[model samples]
Target: MKLQTLALFCAVSLLLFSGCGGISPKPSDETKIDKTLPIVKLTQNGVVEDMNSIAFEWNAITDERVKGIYVYKQRNNLEGSELRHYKTLENRFTTHFLDNDVIPNTSYTYSFKTFSKNAESQMSEMKIVSSLPVLQSVVWIKSIENMPRAAKIIWRPHANQKVKSYIIERKTLEEESWKRIATIDGRLNAEYIDTGLKDDYVYKYRVKVVTFDNITSTPSEIVQVVTKPLPNPVKHIVATTDLPRKIEINWEKSEAKDFARYHLYRSTSSNGSYELIAKLYNPTFTDIVEEDAKEYFYRVSVVEKNGLESIHNKISIQGITLMKPQTPSLLEAKLVNNKIEINWKNKDSRVVKYSVVKKSKTGWFDAKEEEFVDIKGLKFTDPEIGPNTTYYYKVYAIDAYGIKSKPSIEVQVKTPAGVRDNSKKEEITQDKPSRPVNKEVEVIVPTQDFN
Candidate 1:
């Protein structure tokens, strides 16, 4: 009996020691969700009414074995695919999400996953979860003008996400807030048309999650827009030039990246308002003034691509048409009959003007500038010559820029004993008109002549 008791005691000792092999087991009271928020139970709250106020609901808990819960989102269908592991917090119940800031015209599929600090519980039935958030579509706030209450907001379904609805919101820029605008149907949709707006006011727009609960998650980033009528722009301005038969216009070229064509303006007077002369595809423009006005002013303006024009730039200059003079060496005439006929001719008129003057015993006085002064045709005749008297004559030419030259050698003539002079008459050999005998003038803006 002593041996038997001894054997039984040894067996019990072995059994007790085998049972107490490793470390102590952790208690079940404490819960910890670490890397993932496991989907122990998924609850779908059904379809939403107002897309703007739509929302998704879920219940959460960190496994009792984990230290903290790590929340993650699977952008694709919440299938057992990959998840963009995002936020992690100690608490685990905040599983609701708002579909804001998503690209317009696209859908987003969202799902929740739970991670345990124990690492033994794999991604908790993410694919197996019965409930998930189906973001119908994201909408872009349409820009509006001249209406406070009414607006036209638009959006698109999330491309890569599974969308089931759309939500939009609006508020005045002055209010510093937003209100629900319209609820877009996910199945039957294109654009959300909101009408009946105030006359002139500012408005802000945003979007929200569209699900069962009106639990609007968070406001979308506001798309700023304005609604006011545009003011009128100044009218057309004209361009003209100082040179006869010439046009010149100047304008400021816009540094705007969206630059467009330019316009030229013309006006009869410097002070007078201008009129649009023509449209130039370039910044600077030139046109011929056919009428050859005595004076002209010009204006240039910028034209935007959107058909908007800026104020005109104005400038004016004096206009003159100059005819150069010729050099006449021998000029003489005397009274032959009751008619006082006179004749004159010149050398070259290299872009110059000529003035002819006469005197009655006293020295010469100023006379009128001539039109027939060029080297091409330098002759003029006043066909009324009267009888017997002495006449003195001299001539010279001026340049294109209106610089007068010195007088030519003078000649004295007498028409006496009229009938006998017929035998001694000399043939009038007219030379191809010669150019002006120019004096070397110092040029202010000198240029080198190749010749």
Candidate 2:
């Protein structure tokens, strides 16, 4: 009976040992793998490369147990794109990745997860990203003047971070190759002015952008601009003041299709202020100024149809008005000692000379010889007339400009029949006269002082 109790105790002890071996020990919290994803920092924002390529970057993960990284992307409905897994990275130290397969005008969402030795962490925060749209063509290019010789080029700016500078290029219709005109920073000016250009020319322009990574963008749309032909200036302006109180201005017309009208300017002095006096379609203008014996200035300019005015060509002239010398009167003719003598009353002291003309009784008026005397004397003697012959005499006065005055009343006289030519008489003639005769003499001769 003692041997049986021992066997049962042994069997109970063995069963207890077996049940203890079947039970498992609980694990400690220190050995458990984390299920949360690593918090990431954006190292670089989403940026465009080339035209359609994109690149993104982030901070490295800090978890000691992180074995690999998984990058996931989704197409955002806001961007009109589809959702899909973009990439899975086996390297946990990788901080950046490139997305070459990107469409323009489409948006994307990115998320990353960390995988430990036992478990996968939760996905990190989703990152919204997109590439910039392609560079578009220019909208329009034009000139500001009606007769254009310069152009202004304009374009829209790109909104991407990679864009650094803009390049402007041009090609004229006469040239075969393209030429770069300007390069501007995208952060500053957006428009360009091309001046000193030829008129009536056709030009084409284009633009491009450069990124920080030294990548060039596609060229913008081409714009074609045609310039208008410039009009020529008015030529040969002349001013004349020949009338009593009027000034006449004349200029050659500009033979241009864009010729609209003309403008006339007047000034008292050559270098003084000028005022607009008249607007005319014709090239000739007559100004009725009341002032006399004064100098006047004038200018003329042509206006184009586009409102551009040509350069002014100016002219100046002086006008004068002087009184004429008075006529002489009281003409008388008489016969003395077979010679004829003629006299006239000198009423005008300004008269420089006097003229005497005589004709036979039945002779035509054209067959008469005229004699002249200076201010020295008012009387003349003729000895070549035959005695008892009928003759007629007249007198006139002359001015400085060789203008003649009215004639005096005609007188008739008769000479004695015994008279001969003056050359035959010895007493009335001298070999050499005291002063030059029958010519213009400007000497101050001795005269009887009436005072």
Candidate 3:
């Protein structure tokens, strides 16, 4: 009994020594059950930056024991149990991650979990991420002018992907197949210049982008352009005076490409100032002259569909209006047997006919009294003259060109003092002749007011 009491005392003394030594005690059951992990808030959503690539961001975890974040990805069509392990990050202080391996044009679901040395917490709120497909095509392709026989193609850079090169294709109006003309590196500006093209021909173009993985994108929208052609001057230009008081101009139609119209220019002299007279869809023009026997110069130029005019300084021609015949001369008037006889002499053989005009004393010259007289031996007999009154007469000649001649010198005559009795004077005819008087009365026809 004494030994058992000694053992009890020793046990009590050991407990007091252990209490004086300040030894740590075992954790309680409540402390052992608490296994809470870090809670993180998503600062930014997942965003696609390239083909099969996305970036993610989150707030820094507040738990000191958090080792890192664990990322999990799953197809959007699958349930939460189908999530696959994507990546694991060991950096406890890091709050972002970039996932590079994924399928393009597909949707994926993602979540993050905080892990410790001995335990893994429940994942943060689920997030959805999607990786988009590569760019389909470039944008805004167009053709700019480089030369008459060349074409310049330009386009905007592709978006949402990395491009390695560009391919340019062309096709003519009559062709249905496309031909690759150039390969431009993506590092340079999105442009290409194609040379040695046929003039006046229509062409179509399209562009395609190639990725770094050697995948080609869909072709761009089609663009159309027509090359300009050199101007072709008109041939065989002619000018003639076939009409009265006008000049007719003509030229051979140009057979060159893009023939639009013709331009006719006129000038009074060959080296003088030129004026545009007419623009004709046809090849002919008529210039109406204002004065008689005037000279005019003419030239023709070809206008192309592109508004280019051919050079015409080396070609020119001249034309003149029809010439008018001279007037008759030596007009004579005499009173015979109460009738007046008029006669004139024409020096030009071109004169085909003659006209006579008369006026009584103290009477205005009436246009109605003008008469076209047949030039029978160049003489005319006037049976309507009055007695004891004087009359003035003038004459003109008509030429073969339908042109009128100048007025002839005037002539004056008076009948006998007695009235002309119609009963006594039978109508004078060409079969009979009238006796002439010796007295000659004369007046001059003023040409200043002649039409």
Candidate 4:
């Protein structure tokens, strides 16, 4: 029981001395000073300063008992601030120290102490120093705004010889934060081209220089630029609807100085996807469909020399090929006096001529058909037909443009049987009893109409 109680008491004492959870407290400033030990002395002219760094040098110590030295620093801007342990030089003969963690245009107070195994000398007389002012950025910057879908930035290279590279930053007008866009490697490279940018958009840019020691200077002046817009669309487009087997499209020529060509698009319907059919410098185009009564839609756009195209026009023009002539109407068909006759009426005012198509059945499985073209009259008589044979006939009209219409309704007719030859033979009579008299027969057949 006594051993356990002792162990508990030791554990509580350890926690109390180590400030709970086995963590040590922060070290306090040194109060005990050994006046007999030698203190560090600073050189008369051993301080060098720059915008981002400070270097200090001191007289070397020859004391064998001195093991190392401790350096402490305090910011001058903070009120009632104590010196904080910054670094330690483990060798007694070390005479130089560099502080690069300090910022520009800031003052700091520093002190040093010489220490042995168990004792430290008094703090040396404090030294106050300041870093130089911040470095300036490049002077001249220019931006080219008229490039298509891109922007070019140019500037005079930084005059400082310590510069290593340049950092380019950009921001749009709607954004409040600047974004790092590029890092140029060479100090003498004075041009940067930013591509794949939005057209007709405004952007802001600035340049920052990095030194050889990796110190970034202040940003240069901001420059604003706008990318070039797209080319203008073609205007006053017209399409012909009355031409046969072809469509003619015409538009006003582009007036832009950078115009390169025109794009022609075609589609079957107004809402269908338009396909690019042609690219040319001429303002007129001919589309030959080689079919009658066909319709199509079209759109045109202009392209610039940089291959930037204008927006597609929402309105499309409709074009159509010429239609064929109206069909002819059959009026009458009849077989009269060993002949077949067909009559038709022209329904279209554009019809200039007519044609008759005749079909005759010559045998049980064989038939013959013929078309009589360029007939000036509406009625046709076919005398070349065989007797007692059925004949079919149809009529069609033709226009001045050589376009034929649909055939008329079919008409059929059968010719009557031809007259049979019959003559009686007279018995031979002697002397002057009788002379052979010839008998003449005439048969009249009425007209047979098959409508």
Off by over 4 Å in 1: 1-153, 156-222, 226-242, 251-254, 270-273, 291-293, 313-351, 355-384, 387-451
Alpha carbon lDDT of each predicted model: 0.45, 0.64, 0.72, 0.80
Better model by lDDT: candidate 1 vs candidate 2: 2
Order of the predicted models by TM-score, top scorer first: 4, 3, 2, 1
lDDT of 4 by residue, 211-247 (tens): 9988888999999989999887778899998787899
Q: Write the per-residue lDDT of candidate 3 for residues 149-219, one digit (tens) a residue.
A: 77888898777456888989999878879999888986456888887777767888999888886666789
What tens digits encode model 1's per-residue C-alpha lDDT throughout 133-231? 334334433455443344565554445323445677777756765676677656335355566554345667776655443333345556655543222
Give me the overall lDDT of model 2: 0.64
lDDT leaderboard ranking: 4, 3, 2, 1
Model 1 RMSD, rounded to 1 decimal = 18.9
Residue 194 accuracy (lDDT) in model 3: 84
Q: Estimate, for each residue in 1-451, the C-alpha lDDT of model 2 and write its tens digit.
A: 9999999999999999999976433222344446564755566554444345667677888777776766677767755555444566666787777877766666778776666666666666787777666654333433333235667776666666677898888898778988999888863446777776677688788877877755566777777767666567677777774454577878887787778899888888777787899999999988876554446787777788776676574443333333345666644555554455565676776677777666765334434544544434577665666645666766777766555566776667655445554533543321122332353222212143211
Q: Cα lDDT for residue 105, model 3? A: 71
